[model samples]
Target: MCKLYQFVPIFCISLSVVCAKECSIVVLEDSNEFIKIADCSRRGLSQVPQTLPRDITVLNLRRNNFQIISNFSFKRYRFLQKVTLSENKLQKIEDQAFFGLSRLNNLNMSDNTLDLLTVYTPEMFLPIENLTVLDIQRNIQEHNNDVYRYPDVAFGVFKKIVYLALDLAPIPELGQGFQNLQNLKSLIFDRCFLKFLRGDTFENFTSNLEELRLTRCLHYFLHVDDNALSPFPKIAKINFEGSCMHLKQALSMLSSYSGKTLDIINLRGLNCPRFNSDEYPFVLTVTKDMMRYLKTVCVETLDLSDNGIVDFEENSLLSFDRPECIKHLYFKGNRFAFTKGRQIDELNTFFNKSIALKTFDYSFIPVRYWLEENAVHHNEQNYHSSNNIIYLPRSLEKLILSNLLCNDIRRHFMNRRGSNLTYLDVSYSYSNNVVIFESNASFTTETLVLDGHFHAALYQIEIVNFIHVKTLLWRSANLLYAMYPLDNMFYKRFITWFRKLKKLEHLDMSSNLLWILPDDLFLELDRLSELRLSKNLFQSVPTQIIFCSTIKTLDLRNNLLSTVDYATRVWADLMSTNHGFSLYIEGNAFECKCDNLNFIKWIQETKVDLDSRSYKCTLLNGTVITVLEAYETMHDLFSNCRNSIWLTVSSTLLGTSIIGVVLLIIYSKRWNIAVFFYRKFRKMVEKNMVKVTLMMFSFHMAGTAYLGLHNV
Candidate 1:
């Protein structure tokens, strides 16, 4: 009995110690980046560790209310990098705010009320000499003029720093040589260049950085000299993804610069080919020497998307050298062709020998070459080499052949040679009038793109498991397959085939014959985000469309919508406020009655983007107006109708008097009543008044016939 009692007491103590809640501790071992702490709350604990572990990067102190950080407050951890102080109430950072730790990098101070930063000193960053990456996004009061005087002393602070992201930085003053950041690898000046960043403003790291990503800049094409990019010995990547370029002279100079090491260049949104022919020279861009440099090894990953280049230069593809270096080309939105047979032989020879190439994406290129001979020669080779797209060769990995393009159909008819092709997208083109899979099908594509248009009467496109395709692409196709005279089994087969796709990420079924979708069809989505079901036969909004929570973009434009009200509520139920999505609802005729009241209300409040150009007020009565101007027009027209009604009421009273006068004047026999009544005063004058009124009314009615008022 004594031993049992002693053992029970000891067991109770051990259990209590193991389950006891300890004090909240968030320690930063060596100032690394990224830290995750769950249930970081203990009763009334106010302060916690400001930094985290050495290897753990990108800390999220989100939703935590912190007031301030003293000097060396986060200097304990040297390896700590990328700290996120977002969604917090941080007021200020004392002098030497992030000094001490040597390797500390990437500080995210977004969404805070911080207004100032003390004049920087050496001690603040002495601990971390190789510090790089800093982001103070969404901070309201980052502009502290007292510290933005382009102090030469601050220039040497980041001598070895790289990857500087100061988008929407609150610094008021900006200029070249503001700081001598000699070792920057990437510089992101998003929107911050709107007011700052002159021609020479990027001199600090222009000579050193390899990647320069500028988005939302008012002047995307800021000008600079050869010395601007020449400073960086190993420059490669460049991205101008958003907005148009600012200067054309500088861009042309850079593209043709001989002393440049730029390998990965993205001229997206630059619209290079559309460069006002009058102001910019397009013909002389890729000179013989420039083409040789491109082929040899100067640059890679060429992007001409959104350039609107429609002119076909026979030597356009031949300008770049052999496949030993250049690969992965993108010529989307251009009108290059082979009309002149001057360089067709060279292009074919280059395509066959270039073995170091990979991906090739060509959206729209006109056909001017010897159609029959060009297609036959290339088709015979089954061009699948890495560098050239002239033939479908066995070495090809990813090939995108737009069906609408003017290419030989026989080349892909059998496509038995496309065994090595992992990704193949064939949207029909003008020249590819006929396309069908040959029976001796041994090659299996991992990705297959179906024609997005009704050029051919392919009613159903569901592949069997015989092909190794994991993704099925539908490009902007709108064919009422159920009513299609060609294929009645398309709808049924498509539904069954879609369920079998286990690794499909992108599915485009926009502009089809879908009236409403069954709920079960959406359950097949694993992580689908982009859906294009616009311009369908749907009369009412489909609620099942919202079941896919992973969907980020839902395009229902050019659809059969009568009102915006129901769609608004449907969005509210489907989309969480914090997780908003983009909804495309253009070209929809909203019934301009009580039904539209809800739609208008929702459009004015929701954060989603609607196609503003297509928002025309469509009414049941054959009248149309812009949605923005609908209410005003209705008020004006209703007022005019009201005025017309009042005029009719007054005219009726006048007509009665005129009719009586006409009876007295025309015959004069009915004047006895008027004469008798007026005899007591002035009967003669009253008799003439009736005669005059009768004549005027008769003239008015006779004129009405000519005025086109049929009833009048």
Candidate 2:
């Protein structure tokens, strides 16, 4: 007692104490009566603490080497609320480790050595109903449910927990998994559930569950038979990020008609195939009456991704309601090449029917494929556009159509009309002079994302008399727009028309051909806050932009950037006179030689947003090498010889030497250095290639074995 009192120094003084290579301890003597155990990091203690003080509240034993925890090891921690034991060596928890924690709430056990929970009893966590968050991740141990046993009663307590994570390993079994959990909200099961889940496993989720996740689960071949998910009727949301590539039998097995579920269904890793044809069929199938019955289905967000199905029936679109009432549709990462006129007509039908649809995303498809296929859906025989998708839905708000080819640009040639919707993301697209805008239409749109492509001349955009748009995103506008007299009068008309948009808040023109913003562009709508102008052709930032007091989050990645002194000159003008702003200069190829070196050094030393990320440079001599991969010094980014003497001398010397050497031992045959090197490299590469050149070897072997068996 005397030693404890002496060590309980109630002062803010530095106290350093090193522990064993596998063990460390920190005693925080706060102004209060309890001892604050803090930072027992990087030690190798394999067991749970046996001598924890009763009054300790904040215990941080992160980055250690702990393994097992017997009964009553932490039963005395009744008031322990915050405990972080991340990156440890602990595996199994034997029931009573969390016995009587009344006020315990946040437990972070990330980066541990546990794979699965084998033995847990009801007495383990009886007093823990007030927990709000729990995290246990990164287990290096093996997980096999045949050997591990479930807890006696898992859901008996901790019902009020909000955020829960078993990220490292999977939950082995559902035996008494969620028995009394009445108010569990956010649930996460990452890389767990190695085997198929036994139905009736979640029989305890009788109450309304908010968010449910199954990320990286091994046994994604789970089905809902009889009483499988009976208790979880009020589950509003579910995210099934299965580790498999495809779901063959899953749709038939998991599709429930209970009518109690609602909100969202995120079929993530939808690209991963799960079942084989022999094991589970019904993939890419238009069978029986399931397609017909899908008409009555309703989901907020439908994610059908990574399914490499190139051809689908046109009637599939008709399955959805028209003037469409769905919220967000994600079709990215799928090989959805265009179909024929019949499919195009069906899409028109679906769009006309479902009017409430808000967002539609079809980004990341190949430019050629999208253009060749969907952009130009010909009438089976002809390869030209007909009455293919002539109208855009009125309910459309946010649309992402990216990576389109120039042919598709021609097809969408501003000749078509669309809704005056809110948001549009048309980046990674090829825009040409094909699209024609209707006169006097007064294009009324908000938040247009024109990043990642060459925005052709503003025919419709520039000629429009009164265009009302808000939040213009012109990032990655590398190419030239079509000819437009958008100098003084054009800016006046455009700004006047744009100033009518009272809701304008953000203006992102990053990575564009913006040498300078049209003179007084910022004075029009002062409500703008988020401005992004990174990765552009700006030799000098206009000093007038500093007056934009409302602007924050400025991006300036990758451009013909000059000195850091010039950047500071801009920031200094802003900070010294006007106000505060964040600056980004990440990928700018600045001349970092003698004079420019000072700018680079100053940028590093200042509070500017260099972001600590590496910048890649394309040098002349080291042009073949990557800046990130090469261990070269930073001076190479700006160092270049002023005189052509080095180039001339080196070239002349090499030429003379080559000529003399050619006279001495030049090969009369066609065998040169290039030929020799190419042959050697090709031979070595071919030699070192994988031996299994014959793909589908298993199928070939199976066929051979079958033939042999038949002959016998």
Candidate 3:
């Protein structure tokens, strides 16, 4: 009991010592670069590591146990340019803690226990004159339940600050003392509690701020007074995503920034006010009056994703007086009402005037209700309208319709010329609806993405429909069968379909559960340079790829390959010799064995470009090693294999040589050998005959003596 009591203290002391050692800082060395970095993250360190180099330019001390930043704590790091002390237990930063960091341009002190009273002192940030980016978000924790307002002069000294993130609670107003921050270009106030934006809220910014983010600040609505953003004439970008504001408030916000060309306005999830919610469910249509102020504000990109917007008032897009000014629009995660065949006319007329609009994303729009409504309407009308075509803006180049219901996209785009659209994405569309492409209704988009499962009725997506497609992405389509291997008919169809894309340059069929491809799959794709078959069930390098001379990059990552065979490597080497070829085989199951010695050697010597990292090969005894380590010590590991191969070749040559020499002796002395055998045979025959004759003579002499005796 006494020994156990004594050992407790020793063990505790040893544990503390080990923990101290684990908290040691690490300095990254860059031999070819001048920037030195010190990383002390997640170490439970109570204080900064003083052993770091004085010339370190970047320091990361996030997620530590630092309670306070003492005065002049970083005075030694004079060359420091960026420092992050986020996610720490910091309660106070003593004045002059960053006294000598004159070159510090960025500082992050977010996610700490800092209070406004202790952090807002005049001397707290007086030394960082060159600092351009400062993030102290989520640090103004409540003290005694009293509302704390930011002081006017708190950040007045940071005249050169370009970006500031103040994602704290209960910030009632941006104080008037920010007039000195004339160079402040970006400001973020995400998750703040105070809602009202008065006209003078940003009047002190002196018109230099270019970007403002008030994302998710007001959970319900954010009221903006008229001319609230009139002070910053150069403000180009604003994000109010998830700020459930009324349409009038949004118009007021845009009105304040009139005559200024805003680059992006992201109002995703606006949750516009619904009129007569009990009578008309899901009727949050964007009306022309709600967008009247947008006519004065020339915004280039507007993202209204997930806003519960069902339909747009006719000529709503024209509310932007100069419709050509708006270029990109995102309407993802909305449920638009497409009831009848002519319901697409609303969309056609809505964007008919936006001639310069280039990109449009309408992904994730559910159409289950629309399908039911259309069915009911069709039953009442007793007729079907096959001419339900959608007319997109002629100037639009890129369109994304992913995760929506399939509505015969080729038929919708039948009127669009091949050269008008550049990219089209119909991936993840509903599988129940069948899409058929008429011979004249093919899309000539440069890029086409067709991922996810299509119904069995979609046996032929028919690559002829995408004859001009240069890049095709067909990932996760389940090209192979589930319970059985790929059928010959399906394989032949794939071959025939892909051969039609004569202009295909890049093809990605990743995550397709594919084991092999037909030999003629890419036969006619003479321009194909890159092929991606990643995340598949390929056990070996596809034999069909060796014949593709135009292929320069082949990505076969995350496959079931145990080892690449010699023939594939030879073909890859040949391709590398003729032209540069990069074969990415990362994330494959590789095995290291004597039989794979040549493959290991090829990895080190092949001219084909292979991934340097993520090539872990398992050995015979279940030991795992990286490709680099295997390359470095492969000679020692497989020396016996090399010796065995040499032994086999030498033994084969020796045996063959001895057999040839014996055959040559028999062939050169054929006549002599035959004559010697003949002479020996004759001698033996003569000896036998002489013995027989002697026996006959003895018998005759006996018979003659007996006859003479009888006569006497």
Q: Would you estimate the TM-scores of all the predictions?
A: 0.52, 0.63, 0.71
Q: State the displacement of the C-alpha of residue 577, model 3, in Å, after optimal TM-score superposition.
A: 8.8
TM-score, predicted candidate 2 vs. hidden true structure: 0.63
Compared with the true structure, all predictions reach lDDT values of 0.54, 0.55, 0.73
Which has the greatest TM-score? 3
Worst 10-residue lDDT window for candidate 2 reads: 1-10
TM-score ranking from best to worst?
Answer: 3, 2, 1
RMSD (CA, Å), candidate 1 to true, equals 21.0
lDDT tens digits by residue: candidate 3, 1-712: 0111110111222232324333223344445545666666776666666655577788888988888888888988989999999999998888878889889999999889787654667676778877899998877555232344566586888888999897534435557777888888998876565456677666677687889887765443455676777787778898877665644466667876666688998888766443224422334677777777776777799887877777776656435666678899888888774444445565565568787889988789875534554544434444444544456776778888788864422225333443267787778877233233444554657998888853332364644456788998888888665213445455555555576789999999899888877656767889999999999999998888877888889999999998888888988898888888899999999988788777877888888998754379998779999766777887877778788889999999999999999999999999999999999999999999999999999999999999999999
| The best candidate in terms of lDDT | 3
Give the C-alpha lDDT of model 1. Answer: 0.54
